[model samples]
Target: ILPNVTIRMLLISTIESLSYDSQRYLGNFIKRNDLPIPFTYYLYNNETNLIDYKINFNLLAEVQCLSTEHLIIQVGSPTTIGLESLNTSGSQSLRSGCIDTLFGTAQIDQNKEKSCIIFDVHGTILSGINDTIILALQQYASLQFLYVTEADLETNFLPSMINNSISKPTIVCIFDDHYDKHLHDEHVNLVQQFTNRYRMKNWSHVQWFLIPTKNTWLTQSDNKQYDENERIQTLRSQLSYILQKINQTIIDPTLFRTIFQVQSLYWSLLHYSMNTLNYDSTCYFEVESELKQLFNDLSDTTDNLLITTPISYLQSKIKQNQMDLPRRNKTKFVIDEVQRYENLLKKIDQISDHTQFFIDLLTKRTYMEVLITEKYLEQWRSAYEPRLRSELINEKHKMIHLTSELKRIEMLEKQQKLNKSIDIQQQLQTAKENYEQSYKTLNEIDTKLMNIDMTIGLFFDEILSISDYNSY
Candidate 1:
């Protein structure tokens, strides 16, 4: 009863040439059709004041509506006002971001563009049949497309994500105007501005349609003229064709619910068309009824199988040499390693100059020859005694000692050669071998001790035995 009371509607167009005489003919044609609703169309006319009718007259002044209740249903150029309601993650932008935005890929294909390229969202494109068409299109062209439905993205695209990295989503895409007004007005305006900005570049960037179900008021004798059943039959035929195309194929169960909402909304409009149900009365009875069933069916069918397209996108670009392909980010791993390596190189450079000075002192051999052992020890102590209590060799003293030892060896060798004795040479060789072996063994022992200390420290928190070992 409420649905029949006064079904108000308004259709907005941008064509400037619609004549005033055409308006009366348009009204008569609509009246002759016996439209169930009180339909009021607001089209572009230079003579008429369209501002008062269009819901969004705050901006587009001259192009407006006459009906107060009906909202702006359709915009001729989505760029004008229709797209203002929704955001555009356009195919071009989609192309820039990733590989295989199938629609964007299609845009690259001159053949597909030259042919009929319809972005059918409502009836033919979204559910089952639409997916098959998209798949077929992909076979022929480089395509870029994105989904814009109200289903859970995680539920719909998760399997594709698992199969390939290119499936990672970079932006949000939706068919709705705004996400329930929770979004700030500023943000909404920004999104409109964003869409307009893109539309200016590609007039085809956006497309919108508000499909109102036209119905006739049932007449007593002539009521047979109302093809009510034809509507259901047509809807069924379209749905069946889609189901047939997507027969063995599976889609995200979440996508089913989303697609179901679109279908259900259309289905609910049926009751409204018949003047039996209103919008809030039962939002979308048909969809609400079958959603769970649809979910179960899709879930049972596609269980573990992955889609083919996103998987193709996920393949490594180096392997394919595919241009405009999506790339994976290894930032977390590579960036940290690069930073650590740079810091290590800096520390190495700081120690290099000190090492060079020590090398020079050894080659010069001046400090050891001047030795008073006490004075040599005092100088070493002044440099490092606070850090280590032991009177050990410093770089200066070590160099001096090596220089003195070499001099002694030379003197002994010269004397032994004059005497024609091999004993001194053999003895010196044996001593050098023994000294090298001792140094190697000492280094090994130090390493072993360090490892044991490290092991104990690692276990110290968990093992009380570590404290006892430390005491020992």
Candidate 2:
């Protein structure tokens, strides 16, 4: 093993049948001392038989530590009554094989019994046993040891693990180096069945490696560092592969939910504006443009696989929805215009009271002015005009008498009478001109009143026509 290699080893057996005290002591000793690899001990309940123990073992080995690279040693008599049918060879034979594959040689005590198996800090086997024993180990594993029961693995661990893996990514490796083909198949098939049942294939972030009896175990202690280094490099490569897959496939549910919420809010606001209040197309487009820009900016800010996928999806959805906006706004504008025209008609109809007041004032003023002008005309025609005519006749008679006498003094007196007649004629002419000017003013006022009435009538007609058109 390399100085930096982090190794984990598991020793499992029943408390009753195995040398529990010795295994526990050895595990503690390895953990307490400075060592390159770590060791853990697991003892089945004294009451549990080998069958239940095997089930527990398979559960932990296959599920809990699936992604971990660890050495698992079974410590018990293989020929125990309940376990005899489990494997063709004895438990000692399997232990011997594992030791042989790890250490390349076997060590024996004075009683010819296999002693403790030990690996130095450098992963050199200080003492062990060996021969043609087969060992299986994963070339690449990415996780550390995890202690869990079968029930926990099925009920809690697998579900949570799969969920977490979908968010990020993970690779799990399982090595089935057992001599029994049925046990090997059972171990690999169970995991496959579970993954299939849960639809794990849909998630591209998780990967599974199931290895069957491959004789790729390290044969020499000298090659331990090289093998571990190679495993680490392979794990790094796989991690890169997983990251690439995540970039391609992962969609952020949170981002999608957020975008959906925004889209819903925008639609709600649009509906409210169109149905309840003033709907300004220019203002709506301005707000919509801002929202689009915000979304685009958010998309540009992050390189996270989760955020990017949903952002792209929502952008497309927004684009599709935007295509219908112009048509919807056009309809809204027509509805608004119809509503405004209706309101204008209501306002015009309500002006009847004020219109009557102005009409009465104009008619009364015209009548009063016309009566005053007629009175002035009657004063001129009945009194001032006759007096002037009588004076002129009198002057003419006096002038004729003076002419008949041919006297100079009498003629001068007649000329004075004639001048008086002319002055009266001038006053009558001024009165007639005043009457004509008053009549002209009255006519202009009447024309103005008629124009006002025509304008009011036209306004009403336009409002009614618009109402009828809208109804049609």
Candidate 3:
């Protein structure tokens, strides 16, 4: 096995350009699988300014592929003049993947919108935990900002930054609340290390911040995006915020310490800069591509399915009506849930109407196919549109059902208040749960049903054969 190597020493000029990516080679790698050794890569360009320590430059160019026994190394460029020169003697093995090295100009811009546009992070500049504080960090800058995130929070994330060449200040929001003192301290250490080691000139704000609770999240790189090697695969996350441009007034407390973690130093700095609360906040989902995905998924379904699960959930709630102690709390919850669901359904519809034009634009795969393959677009539409249609139908159904549920609940509430002896609480809870369960079930079933119908229609006219229906 190859001995675990540390960044015992790395020599570079100024890290000109930093891209969070797998180590890139102008060529490829080949190796056998049984060589038990773990591997990673770090690279720098020729002008990396590390000419003085050329002798200890024990860096591996990269291994290409692996088999069960032999580990193969692929040297692509002439820079192998000073690469990893190691020999091993052990039963250890190297499980492997690509190691990316995207080194270019060292980005020192706290103003992400202006400088770090290639490796963008999210959450810091999207919506806050409070929802009202949208894109606070990025908006503070004069430039328009875009927020992106993948469900996978580890490797997929940084590589995306590299692929997109996103150097912009982005916030990687924490979706989970798991924590450790050692881990937290590590993050704190990283924030301090980069600030001190990199010695960024004219840099003002601390770059990263952690938001273990809702009270702390800043649109700062310190809040989320940190340049640390140990964090590459660590299961920890922080909220990110980048100063897109310098602000002249009191920094938003929302960007720094409040009820929680203080990963970014922006809030503290802002107070010293100016002491006035700022009002210019951000509007959310402006670059509604993700929103459109949900729309697309719903649009693809047939019309029969109605009422979405989210709508039902939103409607789930308790009312102010009194009930017998045995089931009053339960009934109240149901009533409240129903009201919330109704409001959400209304909101979804409102959103749909607001963005219908975008849907029309997206549905025109003809335009997309001009740049992509027709077969691919066909597959995408078939896969996505029916799902979207099903969502729409399910949402409609929820609104319909919830509207009925609400009326029943109101009656139940009134019965308890006016007609003293009605045992409606049990009935109310049952109704609410049933509606909630049905709403979820319908969304799943509706899409399948719609797909079946659409597929049948694509093949024939008035009547669909039983065999065809079954096949779809």
Candidate 4:
């Protein structure tokens, strides 16, 4: 006989395994059916002696049942014989007995008052029995009986269970090898259905283990080498491994939460730095310092350091470029001012290109936050920058032509006394008209520049909205 603690641990492990498996199953079901529903799993172990366990279980069950549409409650090892008695009896007795075992007589009316489906599977069916049993315990409660060899469990039975379920139903499959290949294949196929439904890349959520029944019932001489405590520890370790396997299948929700915040902060910093580039020559150093601090903060909270490496490198490059900028304040000549303006424009282009590069890098990752950021970045890069650059180039060319015409007119005016020609007068008139056109063009460019700034501000606002919406 097993000690109470070992038995409790075993029961807990089994319930946890089933809970995770059901979660995987429901997750798949929702995706496959294209249903707008969230899934949750709750495990209740009535056989455990801990009063706290019972209290917490009841509290959670009540909360989950009311809160979620897709809720699964799995009760573990409720009676001495466990779920073994459900398979041997017909519908009426199965209902009465399993109901009492699962929820004590005191709690039966309360459990029956709630709307949920109860499902049971037979362990002995792993020897290859073909059976389908459905028991309606009450108007609100029902018990489903399934055997390992039944074809419908995968096809008709499970689909029906999910369809008829007011809330998500907990499915329990109990198996013992019996070394039968066909029976094993059926079980494998059943599990594969869930795996395929969930679109899992691996068997992380599926719990399959071989329990050493013979070792548990060993004679004193056979078990002389190992003490009771050692055996219990061994059993506990095996159960722990099974639970760990299931835990590894699902991505931690906390990681997504952290990534959401990090991605938002990253985009905000990029936007702020880009905007500051328009006015501040020393903004690169300041932005780089801020980014380094941000990276350090994120690195402390998450294991995804590699994802931030590109951004870090970009910041370092910006800092280096800032250090290399010419220190002279005012240009001595017009040509020097022109050169300075060109250098500033080139620096702005580099900043924009690098910012785009960082956003592109984030888009390659699979997180929703990254994808959303990428969408906004793509919109800005594709629509905003090219048009702005084209307009700037056009305006610069017009300014250059106007400057050349003004110089020509000055030369012509100096020569007008010497030449006294009608053609010179016409040329001067044309130069004045061209200068007036240049002023108009300059005004248009200024207006466009203001619009471009407003557009950029709007883009930043949209990004901020995305961050706010997804923060939770």
Candidate 5:
């Protein structure tokens, strides 16, 4: 009874029994039900009087939960046909119950690894089109229903919608009613506006699509039956492609969790810097306690991820590598993650070194604080200052080394492009240019990093300034 509800009337009849008048009546019924959401009908001739109950049940059940109505009529010999309406009713009940249970289970699984698909529609979407999308998603294992939210352009509502998404791998499908073979000017303007907003944010993780509604071809095609079939098929194909992308793009949870934990540890260390020191020994003691706690937490996190996770990852990578098929992006991601784990380990080792040096410096300074005299100042200037300068220089050089490692990764990416390209000579030339450009870019990054490192070094250098210690 809803104004936007779609109505599909399916007629399954034998050619011998479905008389001209019955067909005419069915056509009139369809015409009466036709609305903006494309209330459509499909006819299947039951020539052999054999019903594919499973396919019929699934197709019927797919759209049953939506605000749509289906009028299914079976016209065959009484002996050949059972009560199909009853069968459809039972199937719908079974499917709806199962879906409710399964959706709950899927939500629980989402806590471990969540991904989402968002649908943005100009108006109401028909049940049949939704049914096609469900069928397509069913083909992929990694895809699951997380949640759906509406996006409104009139209020500039897209940014809020994006922020509300909890999952990392998100796909947004914006269905425009005004898109035909050529997009309407209004639709084009809307797409441009939304795309500009999306691009401004540079949302790398979320994939965006502007999809034409199935009803676009409704008025364009004279043959309704053929056009509807084609429309549904096209919808199914597009859905499959998008779902497959989401499936492939899923990040391995172990790698994601590990990376996040490590990055958090790094930031925690940054906050635990020597700048927190007052001239009092208790201040140094407080920083040492916090630094030690950070080190313990970092060690525990890295131990769990590095020891157990990499072995499992390597085994999986081996299995994927042994497979005959071309490697998927996930396999490549695993390889990249292995490399990242190595980088993280090195960075952690560097952090450990820095932490240990500070700990030792604090202990020695506190020990000599009792003997504060001209002799102590001379000993500090001669002994500790060179060590402090050496450590500071080492820290500055480490930034350069880290930046080079990033440059190497960038070079590897260019090498990958060359490996995939068909024209080797041309690709080599392009790669050379890219390498040169990347090298130049990397030098600029190195300079910025050096400047940042110098700024940090000033803070450490201030700690060893001796004038600050002279106050004691």
Candidate 6:
């Protein structure tokens, strides 16, 4: 139902394009489509002495339907009109460009651009009343404006929200019969039951409201016009309030990006601890402490960096590297820590500069520890281990020489036994004493060889456990 003038213009343009023979069918075609036939009413004139013909024509019209008027106001004319019907949010100026609207059930997973979504739970997308609601919502650039079938609402939308898959702000408008003028008792129960279900989940950021269906608003009798206008105005106010709330509550993209950056660094730190450092149970305890503080901060969802300075638990773990944890237990601990962080990361949707700073500090500390380990290992390989090996080799040569000398002296003493030679006996005793001393020296060297590998590790503890490193 177009405006009366627009309909006349269309009729005139259509008639001009047709031949005279074809024009005969136009009136019947207009009646078939239920369009009002254009007609004229002439004024009558009367004269006493002379006949004076005064002519006038009147066109019949009815009150233009609100739905048609609103439709024309939106798409029919270039100039906007009739905006005084509903008061909208003040942020209308903020929604100037193209809106990122994701329609249908296919885009349920990709709604990061959506700040407000209108779920058509009752299938009102094709209705004129819904078109008006959609026009009202188009003032916001951040709105997703989805049409979720009732079946999809249960299977997709609700489940996705509950499973923590959607990351965008959850400002939703649910169109249901619960808010209808002739609302049924069962409708009230359904609304209450679903509201309780969502409340039980305790999603702090979620905000949703139920409104009357399209037919309830537009299909009322003429007697209910006042009530219909009141509901429509109320609907406008609700939409305005929800969108305003969304504007106030939506997280900044920079914050989310920063948060993800810290998350990546945190994972890198964990990877280093597990794979590169092969951290013992004590080390993992320190990691868990850091995780505890991180988890608490993330749970709040509004704060910046929440972990305190110095990380005393990690410092303590560095001092006690020789706690002697079993390999199997160590592996299990790492896996558990990984799983914990995985869950924690899933909950992270925003971050701040403070969080980035905190994670950077943690990463730097771990890097320094790695550097210290490498330095100690390098020293052992370059100097200490080689020196120990050289000493062992020298002791082995001395043992062989002394054994040969003792055997030679014993042979000479046996040869001179018949004459009872004192010189040979003295030589045999000196050679045997030298052999015994060499054997004792070689045994001491062998003992040192067995324990030499652990010296550098102890050195690391001594260096890293000092109070100076604690503050770092």
Point out where model 6 deviates above 4 Å. 1-156, 161-167, 182-191, 253-472
**Cα error, candidate 1, residue 96 (Å):** 31
List, residue by residue over 61-115, the lDDT tens digit for candidate 3: 2221110111111211111111122222221121011111111221223432111
lDDT of each: 0.29, 0.32, 0.31, 0.35, 0.35, 0.39
Put down candidate 6 lDDT per residue, 227-343, tens digits, no spaces.
787777876776666656665444332121111222233344444542232211111223334434443333212221112212222343333332433444586665565455445
- Model 6 lDDT-worst window of ten: 64-73
lDDT of 4 by residue, 30-143 (tens): 334532221112235467743221101221222122110111122222221232332233333122312211221111122222222222322221111111111111112222
Model 5 Cα lDDT, one tens digit per residue, 22-48: 543443343345311112223234786
lDDT of 1 by residue, 173-241 (tens): 333333223123545433354444445332232222111112121222343444445434543554344
| Pairs that clash in candidate 2 | 78-91, 105-129, 105-130, 106-128, 106-129, 106-130, 107-128
Q: Give each model a TM-score.
A: 0.15, 0.18, 0.21, 0.20, 0.24, 0.24
Deviation from native of the Cα of residue 176 in model 2, angstroms: 10
Number of the candidate with higher TM-score, 3 or 6: 6
Candidate 5 is scored at a TM of 0.24
Winner by lDDT between candidate 3 and candidate 1: 3
Tell me, what's the RMSD of every candidate? 35.2, 44.8, 21.5, 26.0, 27.3, 35.3
Off by over 4 Å in 2: 1-153, 160-205, 209-220, 252-472
Cα lDDT for residue 358, model 4?
43
Kindly give the stretch of ten consecutive residues in candidate 5 with the minimal lDDT sum. Answer: 67-76
Clash pairs, model 5 backbone: none
Give each model's clash number: 19, 7, 102, 0, 0, 1
